[model samples]
Target: MVRRVVVVGIVLAVVLTPLMGWAQSKAVLPPIMPLRDIKPGMRGIGRTVIQGQKIEEFDIEIMGILQGGGDVIPVRHLILFRASGPVTDRSGGTAAGMSGSPLFINGKLIGALSAGYLWQPGKRELALGTPIEDMLTVLDLPNGTAQTPWPRTFAASEPFHIGRRAITRVVVTDTLAQAQRVDEAGLPGMTAFIPATFPVMVSGLSPRAMGFLRQALGAAQPLLQYDQEGATFVASPITGGSSVGILQVRGDVSYGGMCTVTLRVGDRLLICGHPWDQMGEVEYALTTSDIVTVVRTLQEPFKEGNLGDLIGKIDQDRGPAIRGVIGRMPRMLAVRVAVTDLDAGTRIEKGVQVVRRRDLAKTFAAAMALTAVDRARGQILGGGTASVKITLRAKGLPRVISRENVFYNSRDVALASLLDLPDALNFLLYNDLAPLDPVDMNIEISVTGKRQTAAIAETTVERREVAPGERLRVHMTLRPFQEQTVPSRVIEISIPRDFPRGPAVLVVGSAGRQVSLESAPEQGLAQLLQQEPQPSPAATLDGAIQLFEDYGKNTDILLQLIPFGLPPEGSEFVKFDVFAGEVVRTDWVVQGEIQIPILIR
Candidate 1:
């Protein structure tokens, strides 16, 4: 049994909902013409913002309706229409960023402007829209069902820097425009209409950073417009047909999607007759938008708009429409990045606000760190070394997680310096021991335009045998890049006094190599060749924090003694246990490894 739902509100008289099949209330609201009553050739007007906050009108004619064939609308319905009017005449046709523009016929609301063709004839642009009944279905969804976002990970890849990259500006559209072939209403045979894509307006990122986003986002990368001066439009209260922004990242770096308001009932509003991120029941930051002008293009016309103040939060994203309230703000994580150019003696700081979703926050934080270093150094690619310092704070943690590392890369040193930040963030966000919320990350990077790296040439110890509780001096020879092997540096490693006397393995190498030696399990040749090194699972939040802190810097020479013996009791193999260890810091990034068999008496 299905009941028609009618909305009751003050601004307009509303009626008709056939999808949900619930009993109707006898309250007055904006009128909605049922899909059954709509017919071909019926004339109407649609509302959208062409410039500024003013909602303008465009003429529309009902062409046909696309019903359930599982082709257009699998569950609900789509109303096909052709758009024209003074506004359409000026802008050429229906543009992107007008996904939820409201349509009215005979003084009754019908649907919202959603999908359109890429190329349309003059004066008339054919489009499809979600019916008002379908759009209203979002209102019946269960509230407070937002789930914690899963952590995201992107493999580091080199950006294609072959040609000139376009500077991104302002506009929000769809990431994917679902293409459909329509054959009805005397339309140009088998015309394909795609849902209007929400192009996310972005600012402050360099060409390199934009390339990073493209690689990171892959096919779902939204159109990005670079704006030096951010959204500065005068504040305006949102209403039906007004422009709005779904801001994912803000502050120093602005990244958000824009769409038109379809309907407003009290404080609640329906928007974007399609999914923004397709993330249902999400809490994304919402904001008002001020349209500068409609960017009329031969390929696809779109609204060029700037994101305004953060005014509310969008709680639902569904196939029919996205829904939100006008006053409740969403939680945002704070990330501050500071970059210092050691050669130029200049520093730049950028503060960005990202949605509380750990995935977006972590990925964007790394990108921001790269951009900060690039902006400070005034270059994108170069051979250099960077000293990176990261401090992470969370609500439930007793103390902040702090770490520092030095990185060197022949190309894109700024990017190489940011490698482990996402892992650290993943540790905090994906840990089963604690729910880390209200996380704040601050990153500091100091860069020098020099490839400061050294490879281990030789390692020598005074004697291969040592008694318990005795200290031994191990000397290392480092081969610097394009230079002679430096004099051997001596490091002291103490042997722990114990009853067990046996053969021990002395490993001298970079921080990474030494850590692996300490944690490596006793395995057969096949297991050693097949299995990759993995971090030990932390049993507690404190343990996770300790693991994060224990990571050695790239500029560290590590010495460790691993006893060649049987596996520990209750364990399959000896793992992460060392008899003695010592860290020797160097000005250059250390590389390579050497192992020496020792007799412990």
Candidate 2:
């Protein structure tokens, strides 16, 4: 009987879920006043923030309804209105951050404050409201609906030059492209549709860190004048007119935008007077925030915000507004950075919950990790040797890559020490074998105040000629950083028995960097054809990791030697053009290209 009841319950749940969802989807929308019914003589009240976290009411009078393409609504209609009452008396004009302020007439919802003109002190404020009916259209969309022109990889993983290059071009939002979009909305000296800048609730950020973020994000940079934060962090809650943060990174380096809430219906929400990236299906952390204050200027007024607790994700960003679902937390990448100082016997470990993304992981990781190191050292500066080991834990990947690297930064030790892991991870994150789902990122960085590096200052060959099966010795003068030079040591190379009687040249340089190799060429055209662009399993995770290892790390020695009988062709490189592990990894970081001539007999 119990089994039957369980089976029947499952059957009913499966049968009734679609019915309930359909009924809900077809439900009547909230009371709304059509754009046609709105008149020039209509008077209404709107809600927004002018001072603090409070959502105060502002009086507005509809001046006219604009139907031209130049208007905010362009084709349909926009209720053009002017500000009045206490809001005007205090603020002097409609502010930029007041975009999402809801407007109502006769106790019925009309629209949200969407567009604004340049504000002048002691002048009546003019703005346009987006119809509420347009916002409700999102609620009826299919669950899997995606925003048009999806986000795709455009650039390689380089600072400010990665992701969706076909669109953004140079930066995440290229200055030229972004300026064009911003201009299309409205031109200065005329009433144009303006999207309010969402407040970014930031904390524990240094000027250097801020500069990095602005560089990465491009023209969408935050207006620092409205920032409200300090060394410590505070949690913001969900309230209309209050700020909500879309966090990209949290901890040493924090980045995110703070948007205002317009309305809430059950678990569904409407926020930000404008769109946030317009990424159709996205999972980004949404946190609550408080308006620290308002920064007023002739250009425009903006609201400063202090971030608070993470709420949920604002999923759908459309034309007029962004919709969010509360209580659904977005997935984040887990990171742990441990910085240890050898001399001081001190170590600090900071962890961050970063937005998991291939385009952003490397940059954000570097920023956050550097911040942690700087803060731990009281912002001191110096060059030092660093050893970095990284472990990447990912889902669906067959192997976890554990890569170790060493660097001696003669300039800034703290920053240089933090470089290898993030740089290496860039290739891993942007690998073509689908997107890597990184569950955890762990980095162990050990730093020493002293330099632990060496280079070959000079080289001398003991003998110019040698018989086959004989060992040839080459002496190298090793120079240590800021230390006494070590006496020359001999490196032996064996002449193979099969070598022809001829002369050969051996050129050695710092390995891994500018490294080239040679192999026997195909004797036949058919064999040579097979060497061309063949498909690579390098498209897989293991293959991608191997690719990263080969070109990413700066370690070992690369020696290009012309064996006795081989011809010195146009291009010395025997390019196999396949994913192969480093064929020549040296224990020491070798430098300089020393050429030595040898005669094989």
Candidate 3:
């Protein structure tokens, strides 16, 4: 009796295994309406956010498909539709952020609204979409696909062309005579389409900061739109058809692009029927967005929105769609900046987190540094001086890298102050040795209206001749800005042993010139700091850190010992086999150079 009972239970377990698996698959994926079943004149309701967080419905009437009747359908697929309703009417067209708005016919999912006609003047009723079947293929696409395509703009002309090929000219008309003219122009009415785009929302940045960021990012389209007050931190409910964001930087200052959510299956979601930068296998912060209102214009209609709380991370960027998983956050680089305005006696502190990507880390880091200074002072341009200190902590590094410098500029002082920041960050994040994880970044800046600059007026040494390995005191005088006279100071310089017993020179100059004089041909200090090439992966991280340790500051008085003879032929600067240097840091931005003749005995 016991053996019979055990055998009966085993049979029951095998019978129910496939049933359980089928139930779970059905729960994760909703029924998809195939493209073949779809017909012209079929009307569907699309979901998207027009104002606030509420998801509203819009009317979509299918006009036709791009593929003509043939034995084999072409891979190029597009669903042409005419959208109308309160949402479309208010915006005068399909807004930019509605790229991923989902279209459902009779409660069956069809596709996402991805492209539209931008040349049409007012109330662009006709639009194009990507089929849902092709969008689902993005889930199986390979990771790390390719470089992000550069944004581009078309010139104003008849029949807009892209790369010598003119897209089908499309126009909507209310009168019969106007409709007849569109057909006479040999246009393929509603066959060709272009991907839609929207400006990334930005907050807490000045115009200069935005311009610098746009240039650095090489953005053809407007990269950042300044409208929101700041970024939000609290998570909000995200559903299909709600507005979403692909965030790069968040906190007091935020930067990201907004799109509509297409579909949600369990914790997974699909957004942007088109590619999001085409950076496959990405880890960008995913957040919900709050739409303010849609602005109607002849150029293109766009939705103005602000980025809200971090809800998930986008892990895939493919041709058809971008896929993300909710509740999982991407790795972020923490940044803290403190700025003080000496003239206004105001101090401001800002904290932000940036997405960590090799292509974007340096650009965003510099933008954050500039924005902090721009926000602290009412203005950062015009005659001023700034002192800055940067501290960086990263994995695989033994100690934190710290640097301090002072800068002065007659115009745009903030930009001048952070000139070296991008180079330093580039070296830290992109060294060829090994992958590094950035831990934290801290920046402190102080700005004043008075120009804090000084020029090296004169230099004198007690003895004209000095022996090798001997120490000598050099007298120096600095002429301060608008000052009649300033006292002289002394800096001690050491002569390295084993020096040739011949004519030698003592060069006293600012740090920038010192670097140029000491650097090798085709391997300047600036190039090395910007892009460091290691011998091999086996090279120690210390080798890279040593370069930063030997670098001089802008506020430093640099002394170098070199041969007094002429440089090698075809060389503009002197190069020495055995080099010795000393540096003294001061409060002012030091400028000018003085060369003193000396002899080695």
Candidate 4:
């Protein structure tokens, strides 16, 4: 039969008074028992203070215990209850400010006070605690080794930029809103709350361009109101209340499109996630007469308001609510490029563009094609005039290239020109799309080539549902000079699900020969036809641990912990660690935390 669990509350407070006198006075008393020795009904005295007055009188009792263990240490549990104590202010009992109050059972450190009930009332209240055993799990001491010390404190580091470009800011907006009644009368009310509204500002570009954008915005009369099933309203959404309003507005700008502008709300300022590449000061103003819809009722009576009233109170002082001077125009495309050569080349280098746009596939293809041409042939070619033929090679589709058919003269030519295929394919796939329908396409290119001849190639197209964190592994076997079973190196490409599909690097090896190739979708499998491969780091748990240890020496905080429960029978426990760095001067921190999976054989 299962036993019922009893839940009780405890109150705790921390005193920061000097320990010298108390230490001496308590020397003769029996040494406080360690947390492990405490049991239910055990009584103890807690010393604390209230409002600057030193008080050493409070009563505590052990209520229950919790237990958990692992390979390294056994965790301890000590649940305590407050029998009597006037230790803190009435409103401050277990307040938010007291998150980590140390608890002692018979003078033994047992757990940290974590939570309490606000409705319990008076000096005798209940509180919950995280047992010392939980802390042991955090410290990776499942077996309870005395040598391992728990980290006294932990702090989150500021996010860092590790890739080629910094992720300055990512703004997400809600596209739909639904209304619910907060009161019985069903009258129109605030559905959403405006945290604060500052002038929407634009800067960085030439005065002519800025003026043109302003004019376009003013003349277009775009609606920025909250819409609920075609109904409109005019009020900021109330906190925790049900109403409909604009969800959010997100904007970000980076290199290749960096321009500075300052948005001000009185003395406040708005800037990018990170410092701008270029800095300057400029005045900002709200683009006037912007339409904003607000949904006031679930029924027929919806209201509409202008941007000004939606953001600012009519009776309050209103200047630019946002302030500061740094940032560029939002980008429409994430990776932009201009290419000069569409035909062929071994090494390619070109400029890249990052911008915002409605169609990412179209923008990405255009930029990639341009960059490929510029790097290969050294001149920008007209992509619009290129008559590109795309074939979907599948079980039932027509073949673009086949093993028995040679489409080009030489394999070198095939591989060199294959760098621009993704762009062509993307362009072909998304040339025309309906407003409500999403264009989706997936294709794989297989190329067979010889130095003297472009032997054969094929494109396989199919619809694939790709979700985040999904892994796609491409297996390639290289056969040079028609020799079967040549010794070839295998390189795996790990495309992070979050990363956009664009220019990517791949390594292939055959007969001890390695080659590096510039790859995009349009170039297809041709660019990889005859190239050698290069060495790549192993993507394994042990490999990752070694890499972190080598490069993470400078990290400020390092935590190694074993998970709860021992490895299954015949299996080894997996070790995990979390590393973090903090720069005190800038209040910046970088965290690298991952769980390493290990198999015990």
Best by lDDT: 1
* lDDT for predicted candidate 3 compared with the true structure: 0.64
What clash pairs does model 2 have?
A: 154-164, 154-165, 199-258, 235-308, 235-309, 236-308, 236-309, 511-557, 511-558, 556-586
**Global lDDT scores for all candidate models:** 0.66, 0.54, 0.64, 0.25
Q: lDDT by residue for model 4 over 30-97, one digit each (tens)?
A: 23345456666677643332222122334556554433233454332324345355543332343221
lDDT of 2 at 338: 86
Comparison by TM-score, 1 against 4, better one:
1
Higher-ranked by lDDT: 3 or 4: 3
Between candidates 1 and 3, the lDDT winner: 1
**lDDT per residue (tens digit) for residues 1-601 in model 3:** 0000000000000000011111122226667899888787899888887776677888999876654222342334667788999878886668777888888888888888877754455677667676899877765556655533322221111233333445443332322334445545654422233564445556666776676666655444345455455443332355568667777777766766777778776667778777756667888887655666676666556666555556678888765678877777888888888889999999988877887775556666667777777788777455588888888888877778877777776666766667666546765676666567788888888889898888999999999899989876898888887885468888877777877678878788877422331212112322333453333222366755654544556778777767667431211122222555567776678888888888889
What is candidate 2's lDDT per residue for 455-506, written digit by digit as tens? 7678777888888677767766766666678777667666556655677776
lDDT per residue, candidate 1, 329-352, as tens digits? 777788999999999999999998
Evaluate residue 411 in candidate 4 and report its C-alpha lDDT on the 0 to 100 scale.
Answer: 18
TM-scores for all predictions? 0.75, 0.71, 0.73, 0.21
- How much is the lDDT of residue 331 in candidate 2? 80
Q: What's model 3's TM-score?
A: 0.73
Regions of model 4 farther than 4 Å from truth: 1-35, 47-57, 67-78, 89-92, 118-124, 133-601
